[model samples]
Target chain A: MKITNVKSYLVEDIVKPFTWQVDRPGSGDGRDPRKNFSCVMVLDTDEGISGYAKGPKGRIMMDLVERRFSSDLIGMNPLNSEKIWEKCWDTDRLEEYPLYAMAMVDIAVWDIKGKKAGLPVYKLLGGYRDEIPAYASTTSYDTLEEYRDVVEASLSAGYPSIKLHLRYRDVKTNAKLCEKVREWVGDDFSLTLDASGLWNYTDSLWFGRVLEELKFEWYEEPMREFELESYKKLCDKLDIPILAAECSDGSHWNAAEFIRRDACDIMRTSTHYKGGFTGGMKVGHVAEAFGMKAEVHGGGHNNLHLCLALPNNTYYEDLVIDVEDIEAKGQGQLKFENGMYSFKEQVAGVGIEYDHDELETISIQKYEKF
Target chain B: MKITNVKSYLVEDIVKPFTWQVDRPGSGDGRDPRKNFSCVMVLDTDEGISGYAKGPKGRIMMDLVERRFSSDLIGMNPLNSEKIWEKCWDTDRLEEYPLYAMAMVDIAVWDIKGKKAGLPVYKLLGGYRDEIPAYASTTSYDTLEEYRDVVEASLSAGYPSIKLHLRYRDVKTNAKLCEKVREWVGDDFSLTLDASGLWNYTDSLWFGRVLEELKFEWYEEPMREFELESYKKLCDKLDIPILAAECSDGSHWNAAEFIRRDACDIMRTSTHYKGGFTGGMKVGHVAEAFGMKAEVHGGGHNNLHLCLALPNNTYYEDLVIDVEDIEAKGQGQLKFENGMYSFKEQVAGVGIEYDHDELETISIQKYEKF
Candidate 1:
């Protein structure tokens, strides 16, 4: 079916106000927390089926889709997602499109295909499983006590594993925090650390040693993603798996380099940052070919679909900003139970239904193109 | 239809033997000329329609397809070229597949889809033009006089452009040869040079300045493909368009980096090196988006198809090893006439038919996997 229209709505205050770790003090690149705005995109086809997806919180994504991508997308076959994706990605040579913008379009196109085929997107992607265990991926907390409380609460909430997005404190302070967490959670629990690409080679080496001693599952992006040589050195020196290239550009192509260089033991992929399902699957399959795990980086319906579809992916990252915000507003239709995430079996498209009426009420701005 | 079988035949002495430029003296990193053999690949479907393509002149590609890729490909829908391309590329994470092996399978798959749809492969790729002007891309000769003779012969054969692949002599010698050729062809003859990546940054700069003064069309691969910083500097220092990354890995993703960094003025793409048709299209579209020409490298039916399909590509490279060997065996059914390359209209699949009888007679090795 030909896509006839593209629409986006900017809904303000849709998500709860939460502090992202990158915005906290001592974080090397301090940035403000994401605003509570959510951008929802919809693709309308001539055949009466419509596709839906959520974008990052801003008008920029909406504006980009409407102004840059929408014209080329109009009158194109929705089932030709591969061609459409190439078209969008082609814009990168000049526009250098933010991964999120392309992701939104790609996810929506997959949604359209799923709806047309009358199957969930995961099934269309060659489904691997219906359910997947999740890890409680935390944001930075202000104090050691606060971290402890969140970890305890996540365990109480039935998460089987936890990944700390610790504040960029001194290595010693972070090591102490890790020690206390291990002491609190015991040795058998699955634990990992994401330093958010905040450490240099030496600091990463030292912190990695601490993680290895603590028996942490994987060390996530301790050094910057561009530091391939440092990563190679780190992987060689430490037994701990280095999970890297989370926010890196070039998708599976770049991940292949990391794999070829033996730079990272685990490859990071998600619909949000990895050019949507097509790109995520490419990375996941590449990692699988290398006998490595490709972890889903964030919690969302799209990421859940990816987790269910990718045979090599380990866990669905249930990003926890606040203990109280665990079952937060933007969780969509995905079902989370006993540390596992599942979705409706035969629900077509992305399986997330939006209340258009509610969105109309909350939308701060709207754009339409044909 | 499902691909029920994959078959490869290594036919010995299938083409005329000619001296390859890379094998000649003074050519840096000298290698032997390709043995006069051709690898013919066929993908048989349950529906009784088969797809055909040619690979490099070796059993390695045949072995790769039969041993590693065939089993995974057997049950797959031949029409799902995108997914299949991903599967083949995924193997590269571990196997590090030569681009030709993957290109063979991809080309065959596209052939199947085109045959099924009753169109040429170029039409399947959204045909841009039925014909593209050809440039006689020469192999390196021993002397400047030989180069002049080949250039004159190519012009006499109706070629509008000539790209000189000169031996790696000193800069002064090469500059004098380029000047002599430019003087002979005059200002408007569309002359270019391919250094085959033998120079360092300083020499590239010097030669590039001479080329700019001579009003050459483009300077190709003056420095190695991996030297992105040097390419950036060269592009900044010279007026001549630099066509880099002809043999680089990572396909369009790496090409995108070169474009983003302004490392090259022209991009290079061909089905033989750039993944396959899907990849060639990606790089071509990327170059088009950036308002740059993506010159199609090498010659053959598949590259001709790419030159036809890609809107941004300037010319089909009719690689001339020996003038008498131009229409020799293995040229397939593509028609070259009066400085242009054209394929049969509405000829289903890749539009090139292979004679199975001739192949069986010359067969040195054969493989089949189902």
Candidate 2:
């Protein structure tokens, strides 16, 4: 199939609120409204099928690809998504770069291609499964009440487990939150503590000790993502497994070195940011070879498509998008039943259905590629 | 100081085509056009001031930043350019991020800010230089004829000295390029060589022996930018100093650490891809603090803003953008004279004026900022 149009919609309503340790938090040094937003790209094919890619940071990346690399895909056989991804990536074309945007778009396009071909996204990725387990990850919170509500909400919403966003607050608040949540959920449920790099070794250690007393599943990002030596040291100091790195740059070398050095126990396998499904798949292969936990980092629908089809990844991060919050539509949004989610067996893309109204609301703009 | 608008222009033309070895020259990858192109970004402020930024893989990085960050700067205070850069970077709201795009935008904004404030960009960074010196970096072929022509061009153009881009050719080529040019200039001329990660341990040792014959100033990037131990070994084995970096990620700590450990002689600086100006300034500061050569890498009108302002950066690279390549207004463009160039005195904002036609050609169709 030949690709026809690559269009971007800037959703006015779906905003992802900022929760960065984004400049030491509350410093007034941070302000990005886009932090609370989503930008979607729809790539239409001449065969009457379309691909939808949800770029983490909006219209720019997808929009640019539409303008620049459009010709690379347009009129070319659309089934060769992986080959096309490689072409876009290998085209360094700059003295230095952000090749990742091209990557995210490529995968999204692949998802669409798979659907059009009447196959699953992961099947094209060498399908390792028909479904995968999931963990509901709370996006953000400001108080204990917020944490409790999210925790209790995730449980009732049928997540096999729950992950917390811990940062910028007092150590006592974290210690207390973990202890209280564990008491509320009991030892039978899986509980994970994600600090998201807001802590130093001392902070991670303090929380690690308390989480141990409460028997938390793992401590995510005890230190910064690349603090390999510290991560290794902390792994030795605490009995709990440390899961990290959704934002580490460098290469698989960064992750490989961490594992080779015994720095982490549970590994976060990410597409787009790290490497796309191909990169993430390779990371999964490495983690499994090393016997590390491989979980999908949050907010990647393209990844969840592959995750559901992979076995090495038993835990998928469920970014409970308030779907109703925005008019986003797709035919492949995965379904959750009794804390378990699976592909719909349509073999047509990810199977998340699309909403036409949501699609109509986003701003459509053209970027110059030639 | 209010940035009423953030106008971004994608510059696809190469002032001078750059050549570098990729896929080892004879590899089948040579047929790839993606490997052959270069892109640059010019950020113009609403107040008739402009800052030029070279992106990470120029076009891609430029697109990513312009897509996500441009809208933010539309009504922002240009005075807080650095602060804005940190926000986009720290939060990382976008996907495929090393987020170098944000950094590129940040740098150009600062240059624009400096020009608007009637100071050199580096002066806004604290008046580190009243005037700076430069090195003539020739990108001509290694063949004797081309080398002779370019060196003569550089000399007639009146640079205090020159640096050779060495690789795939030989010591003989460098000798021919430098010694002949030196002899032609009659002895007082200085020279350096960029091995461009071409020489290894033994190769460096061999080059060291041969280099003394010509009395080259320092060998640049004699090995890979990160090969600290090898560099240390090479440095110990040679009498001549070694210059390293320029082609690097901002977080090449191992390289900096190696320099900290006395691995090489100079710290080569580049503002294009890493963190744009802010990141370059950080690296420059690190080099200054460590008493290493803050040799400015890459050449351009934008670079002129950097080179003329940093005292610690005694030498600027010659990445030329001919007057014909520049579409900006006025006689503010640079011209080589007496082996030196002067920063315009008391001129406000990045000094270069934009061509209204070029501006209209790349103007935004629409923009809104919070």
Candidate 3:
């Protein structure tokens, strides 16, 4: 079918109040705002079916598209998505042009295409399953007490696993936070640590050893993303799986390389950056081919779209998001059966409704057509 | 300086008979009305001295700003660009929000900060270099004869080095393109290949070894981006310096990891997607710190800003963009002396003058006021 539109939105809120990772210097300090909940997007189609995907923000993505590359996409067929991807990639004159945004345009268009084709987005690329398993990903709690409280809350909510955000700047605070989380969560649960790419290779290695002793399910971005050697080194020497936390990897090419090179085992991805139903399906194909676990990086309205569709998933991460945060609109879209998410019975696109006017209210009025 | 305004424009040229990409096998194949030149942004300011930064587009990035993230940005101190960046990132609540676009908002705000501080954006980031080198990078010509004509023209124009875009789908095309290019350029002159990540590891090794025998300067995206093993396999096994294409990098963090892991010899980056001047500069710093040469991926007027003030760069690739394709007025803001580009001494704040009427004429004119 011919494609009709490529619209971007500045949606404000979903169901969950934007949660944040607050890294305090000491015990009982204020929150850190460097990694706050920010922007997202929604795409609409001519067939009255629309889909939404969350990202860092469309402001940057939109600019590149409307300003430099809109002509790359204008009026064309929607079903022939493969060609569109190639054309965009071909015209990607700038190496630094955000692949994620361009990818989203492809994804949103694909979502619409699936609706038009009367097939689920994942099925378009040959999905093997209808649901995926999920784990619980946590953030920096203020103190050991808070950390323990949150970990218990998440585990009790039915998540079989959990990932703790660990920042080493304040050793004593971090030590206590880790100790409390371990003691509260106990041994049977799958616990992990994400250093958030703050530590150096050595620092991460040393801490990772300790984390392994504590039995972490995986170590997420323990070191910065660029240190492939360190990641490989850690993977080679350590027991934990090195997860690319929230990294903008839409394809499993990197993860495939890791597996091909015998460098890594886990690939962290999300719909906002990588796990859109389409990307998830495509990337999953590669991950499965490699016998590696496709770890879903949490974000946006990550319901059961791609997770359930995946066959090589390690676990679906809750990302420490609250259930109440799933706005009533997105509530039935996916079911959290005993902490594991299952998609709704409805065949709706994305299966989530956003409050259009509410989205408008949150917009900073950056620009409006007069 | 308090931020007072944020403006984004989808500008186009009033004169050119533009062509949007038409072969939409998948996504936007030159969708609707076709024209040239487009841009989107978030213009921030105090009472005086307005600053602009390129922002992300689409539902995800825009949704974040429109939904709730903008409130944190509005009425904030504009001069604290770094602080503002921290704020935008820190306030993120969802697990998977599009980060590239949010990063753009932060970068644009930083641009405002630099402008308000009465300093060039590079200077604000602790201006590391005084001048950056640039090379002439281009696509495959119709034939070796025609290719030589272009190369001869560049040589006469005074470029010390040149690059050839290799789009060979098979070994024959690859060898033909390389053979023609090497033959046309001769042995004394230096040149590189842009494989566009078309080959596999084995193919990469074979192609690289062939290029090395031919004495080609370096091969780019030899075996796909993120194929670290392929890159390392080629680098360690084959002695050629590989240029890391942007498609392989998920973000600066991944690029950093690629470098740390000894991924590429030359860092090929673009200011388009990686968050304008701020993020691009940060990436440049990473490349510099790693002892790799930094090359701006694409060319437009803004690239002139990056190449200037930055030292230790090998080339200003995308050097000769289709200026006719540029959205800004008077594309001659960049003055290249020989192969070297001279920065504007008289210009300030990106030195870009965007025309509102032109934007209206070329743009589909979606929402203007946030």
Candidate 4:
């Protein structure tokens, strides 16, 4: 079906305060984490089927999508998803990373694909599994006791695995904190660490040794993603599966280089940062060919479906500041039971139908032509 | 002064038909060139002083500039050109190709910089020289005779150099045409060739040997820009300086890799294609540091000013289907003198004050909020 219009709306009321170890001082870009808001992108077709996807920090994404993507997307057929994805990528001259707007449009287009087929997007994505284990990716805490308490609480709350978003500035302290969380959870529970690329080679080397001794499951972005030399060196030494490619802008073609180089043990990707379903799947497929696991970063129905579709990905990251905030904002039907999260078989499209009343809580920032 | 707003208007009546060797059948994207339009980008400030820049293909650029750039730019100082440039680049996750809207904003910001300082943008851009040799970069002609006549016409028109945009499908014919144009212009006249990357290594290798034998001035995008191996191999085999990286997305950092790898002998960059004055200058500065030339691609007041500012660039490319089309479309004030083109230094900004009467002839497609 021919697309009629593409519009983006900024919803500010639902902004959730966030802090990550990667966002702390000295983290690259030095951008302290702020309250994250949602920018919902809607693609309307002449056939009367409309698909929408939500992204964090809607303010920035909305502008890029409207300005860069609308004109290219407005008149094309929604079913030509591959061509549309390529058009968006080529329009920006195929940057190293994926455009959030393009990725969101890809999700919206997949939503349209599912709606037309009378199935959920995951099914369209090959439906490898209906469920996967979910890990609690927590925010960085100030004290060692805080890390221990958070780990214990997550275990009590039925999370079998919990990833530590450690204080990156003090690697010694972060290493001690990782040890404390592991001691609290013991060896049976899944423990992972995300340094958020805050460490240099020395710090990463020092902390990676501690994680290796502790037998942590995976270490994500312990050093800068661009520091390929450091990543190669670190991956060589660490027994823990070193995950990367989260910083790979969005092209799987670029991701393929990392795969070829033996850069990391696990590949990190998601729908928001990668180009969309088509792009995300491309990266996933590449990872599969290389005999490596592609960990889908970020949590959403789209991500969950992607994880389900790809046989290589191990877990879906359920990132939360507080588990209660999930219900406070009406994010979606993200059901968590006994350390795993799964979708409730969405009947049509992406299946995230925002509550009308909740949507009314936030002001409709702007809506205009293609 | 704070930027009050950022607005873009699409001037539709002035679309020029262009076909590069890159747009030919089996050459990459395979989309034939159409009548290209211009998008005029204006960055207005609180003090009532405004800066503007023009780019080809207004429909896509207009939407992006208005939607993505306006919000981040509106309340910021126009003098924070570097910061504005980085903000735009980071917002899009820093694509490899220049963000056209960001580059235009950079031009407009520089326009404001010049206006505020009451100097031409070229003067502010180091004012390396007042005059640079002008070359006639022509469209593809059907036959060799048509190409010969155009070279004669351009030479008769007082242009010092001519770059042949040759038919790339047949390397033998293209090589013959290059030799023909060199003979037609004689050994003293500057003769360059742009294949728009229509050749593979075998064709480029075969064609490059011919250009070497003929002693052509420069070979532009003789092969794929991304094929580093092909570029390196070609550059090693050919004596003529291989001009490349015109397709380097938009970041100078990525362009730096090409220089580090010795992929091309000459660098190809432009204002709108390279992320505006700030981003384009960064690439040029890197080229300067590397002891190589940064040849600004495309033609407009923005590129002309950039060429005037840079020490390494040898000529300004004046691309046109017909010389009259340049004046007819009111593109810029490019005065052709004895074998050169130069601007009668305007009072301030980019110095291209569009003829108010000529602007009246085209429709102002859209004007709205940042």
**Evaluated with lDDT, which candidate comes out highest?**
1
Give the chain B TM-score for each candidate. 0.93, 0.77, 0.80, 0.90
Model 3 lDDT tens row, B215-298: 877788865565665676567776778878465443466567677657788776656545456556777778888777766776
Cα error of candidate 3 at position B207, Å: 5.0
TM-score for each model:
0.54, 0.73, 0.69, 0.74
lDDT of 3 by residue, A1-370 (tens): 4444444444333332332344322111012223323333444445566544444444555454444344555455656666676666555433234446555656666666767777666565555566555566665544556566666667666777777775345444565666667788787767777766566777777777777777777777765454465667888888777776355343555556555545566776545455345455566677777676776666333435566557677566666633332222225455676656656664544545557677667754232211
Docking class of 3: incorrect
Q: Which ten residues in a row have the lowest lDDT in candidate 1 chain B?
A: B23-32
Model 1 over residues A265-346: C-alpha lDDT tens digits? 9999999878999988988999999999999889778998999999999899987877686655235567778788898456
Candidate 4 C-alpha lDDT tens digits along A1-370: 9889877777753334554543232211112223334677788899888888887545555555655566667789989999888777655442222356578889989998889888888788878988888888887766666666666667767766888786547877777777777778888888888877676788888888888899889888876554455677888887888998785553586576566556788988788667788888888888889888889988878888888888888898877565464333223586677667777545677887664345555735755464
Q: Choose the strongest candidate by DockQ.
A: 3
Q: Candidate 1 vs. truth: CA RMSD?
A: 23.0
Sorted on lDDT, best first, the list reads: 1, 4, 2, 3
Query: Sort by DockQ, best first: what order?
Result: 3, 2, 4, 1
Q: Individual DockQ of the candidates?
A: 0.01, 0.16, 0.20, 0.11
lDDT of 4: 0.72
Q: Candidate 2 lDDT, tens digit per residue, B194-236? A: 7766655777778776666778788887665434556777778
Candidate 1, superposed: residue stretches over 4 Å from native: A21-34, A327-332, A355-358, B1-370
| Per-model C-alpha RMSD | 23.0, 6.9, 7.3, 6.4
